[model samples]
Target: MVHTHAGFAVAGRPTRTRRSAVALAVALLAVAALLVLSGCSSKPDVVPSADAASVDVAATVTVKDMTFTPATVTVKPGQAVTWIFDDGVVEHDVVAADGSFVSELMTQGSYTHVFTEAGTVNYSCSPHPRMVGVVVVE
Candidate 1:
């Protein structure tokens, strides 16, 4: 197809304005690439710090293979339960039924919640609802 606008651009390629426009386009593309490479465009729901992981975690739940390892855990009141995200690049979080705690969507990180009351706390991954787990506090 004989394109009129394409012909005009081609005819104007030697102009300084065209060179400037091309440079601007290249700069914008470079900025976009940096954003994606640095994960600026898709930041996680929660950004944990270096000291975020608790030392007194009683039970650890491994989030992998679309399931929580040791799906049920029994712990005493005031104990902590930690959920580690290990499903490769897939993101997951722990959300309690009673709104007690909600973790950050993460592919590799951990979230800990201390159980203060004596009861069962049920939770599931927000992205994968079928991936459920329970913390039985006695």
Candidate 2:
């Protein structure tokens, strides 16, 4: 038999209480893990859907002989157009009349613009005003 300093008997009640507490904590953790796993399995996969009305269009203009080739281009709204500059002796730029689009001076490179509105836009080069182009979107 175990005895305390005051001569009272003890029966290991503290050890049994500690063991019960540990068992309860383990059971709670197991239940939480199971709940999380079940929640993840119930959801379906997510995928991005394309819009039926969306369209992709493009046009190209060339800078040659100090002029914009095919000076006028037309396309539908929400279309993208690209300007390719041919290798020329002088540098050229593409600036919009209403400040819509601007391109850096390039001897041989390409610039792309996306037309989002339906209207007519005029563009020209800073150094060479004669090098002009137009874009019509509808």
Q: Estimate each model's TM-score.
A: 0.62, 0.58
Clashes of each: 0, 0
Model 2: how far residue 100 lies from native, Å:
1.2
Per-residue alpha-carbon lDDT of candidate 2 for residues 3-29, written as tens digits (9 for 90 to 100) = 444333366434545668889999999
What are the runs in model 1 whose C-alpha is more than 4 Å off?
A: 1-55
Q: TM-score winner among the candidates?
A: 1
- Over 39-119, each residue of candidate 1 has an lDDT whose tens digit, in order, gives 533323442322335445788899999999989998898788888889998998888877788778889987888888999
The lDDT of each candidate is 0.79, 0.73
Q: What is the lDDT for 82 in model 1?
A: 80
lDDT of 1: 0.79
- Candidate 2 differs from the real structure by a C-alpha RMSD in angstroms, to one decimal, of 19.9
Model 2, stretches more than 4 Å misplaced?
1-57
